[model samples]
Target: MDARPLLPSNEPDVASSPLAVRGLTVSYGEKPALFSVDATFPPAAMSAIVGPNGAGKSTLLKAALGIVPRLSGTVTVFGEPLARARSRIAYVPQRASVDWDFPARVMDVVLMGLYGELGFLGRVKAQHRARATDALDRVGMADFADRQIGQLSGGQQQRVFLARALVQDAALTLLDEPFAGVDAATERAIVAVLKTLKADEKAVVAVHHDLSTVPDTFDHVLLVNVRRMAEGPVATAFTAEALQATYGGRLAVAQLDRVAPR
Candidate 1:
């Protein structure tokens, strides 16, 4: 897969970014997870959110999408508030956070992505099924459409969730650790689909854990450790200094050499 940056023809102003977070903060009880973090993910770009464990990387996404309660901050999608732009965004949560025993077939799970468009009393038509099937095929899960989600391997489950996000055809796609437990082939499939998304002028933002894959996978990176450490193009912002500041001593020296060798 070609991971080269595919810049958008007409870049929108900062205010019109696909996703823009301002003064975002989240807390669990008295513990602050994210603190006044501000970041912007541009259209047609693949961005990664990276940090050490418990560094509020996931919290930032949850807070931005209103999945978790925010103590203070505002989230805007395509220059509009979340409510107005909710349909334009698609989210794939952490695979570990999902319950595989939900008793839903792979097709049923993928169809759930259309519920926003289906609405109350809206029926699932043939075209909707076709769309779901196309999304499944893209992620190499079309054959497992009838299989129970719980019966899938860890990598297959991740691909299914990604297919779920694909059906939405959202402009801004947010994923939490899409490659966490997936096999190499599954990771390649996911990366290919993400690159396709970028080629189509869509924005992809994910909470990524593998620093080594950062340069090869994402063109933009936001380094977070309870706050916004650094953010911008991978060439400049994904430097050794920013990574060190983001991971501190928690990241092994050898790991740094692979990602941001000086």
Candidate 2:
């Protein structure tokens, strides 16, 4: 698979990045998970956050969205604080983090994405339903709208979560380990959806565990290990030295091919 380099033309202006993290630090109890991390995710491209387990990839995503408390620094979405632009951001948490057995229908789950715009307890109008339906259709899950979320397969469940983000019509999206438990077909489908998002100039930042797919799936890469090691176009920044530095020797030589400059 050819690595898709971050095109210079797609790069967003520094003064107005889609997502920017500056000196960000996150801690759990007294232990720090992320340390002074800084990175900018540009619009019109997919940015993959890659590192070994416990490297704070997921923490970075959560902290950026204010889901987890940040011990220091700040996150800006579309050049503004999260609070000022909350409605323009969408998030898809790790599939495992969600309780699939909660007994909600697929459509019901996707509708939750509108809560930001509609207010948490606002009534779901017909227009909202139509948007959710359109989102489901984009991910090829429209027919599963009536099925219980818990009954869907892992791939189907992932699609539903993506649909939730899509329906939000956000300018920036954060996804945590979306491809973790999905099949090849599902991965392909998700990649297609991501490309579409990029085409629409939406910024996508995802916690990606599969190193083999990163180069082929995303244009930018942020390598971290409790701190940001490297970030930029995958071709120029995803070097062997950087991978070794970020993964701390856990990354195998075989996985190197996926990130080799095209």
Candidate 3:
């Protein structure tokens, strides 16, 4: 497993394996989401996992997080086997997957970030509350800490989710569609927050859809459509052919702007 920073920051990213997948295969009943997928996540970098809908983007992340069963392959995090490093990874699921009407307050949800270490029978302690508040402050959501999740805007809800992930204090973060329905300004704010994570030397990967923003925001990209089409540096793997392959041969990328950096 290579731990080096995948993207070159202002200074060259030194290597330290953050996450690695080798021959990873995942299936849901008879259908397969990933097939023999092999990849590595560079430390301290933001990686865009781009793919059309149902291309197994979420499945791959789930497999990595041990939420879904993987038919084969191995995942390792921070130089330790994934199962052994479970406590160091944070996952922010899609907002659409949750019920905002559940009636939980933002601060309460954020405190769940500490539940992994707190044991199932234990309730959130005072220290956990402090950490949740700190995370909300970092995301500029301190004022809305006491608001019910249902009352928040889409962007505000997303920020709360990010705060939850941050409160985990994990070394690696996986976000599924964090920018999907947010406003442009919200998108910018989220991207800025992700950049801050890189500065702090944490690896963050997002399941992204917008093609125009990939180059400007991501350093590495995993182009997927059902199976792995290409995985490499953004500039090389996000080429016209790669885009077409990942888009299921529907996009006329050959005539599209090829000058964009991957």
lDDT of each: 0.88, 0.86, 0.81
Each model's backbone clash number? 0, 0, 7
Q: In lDDT terms, how accurate is model 2? A: 0.86
Predictions: Cα RMSD each: 5.2, 4.3, 4.8
For residues 132-163, write the lDDT of model 2, one tens digit per residue.
99999999999999999999999999999999
Candidate numbers sorted by lDDT from highest down: 1, 2, 3
Task: Please identify which of the two predictions, 2 or 3, would achieve the higher TM-score against the true structure.
Answer: 2
Please report the candidate that would top TM-score against the real structure.
1
Please provide, for model 3 over 1-262, each residue's C-alpha lDDT reduced to its tens digit, 9 standing for 90 to 100. Answer: 1212222233222235577777889988898888887667778889988878888998888898888889999888876787788888898999899899998999988988888878777777788888899999988898998899999999999999999999988889999999988998888988988899999989898899888888889988887766667766777666766776677667664433743433
Cand. 2 TM to true fold: 0.92
Q: Candidates' TM-scores?
A: 0.93, 0.92, 0.88
lDDT score at residue 216, model 3, on the 0-100 scale: 88
Clashing pairs in 3: 2-17, 3-15, 3-16, 3-17, 4-15, 4-16, 234-262
In candidate 2, clashing pairs total 0
Q: What is the Cα-based lDDT of residue 234 in candidate 2?
A: 84
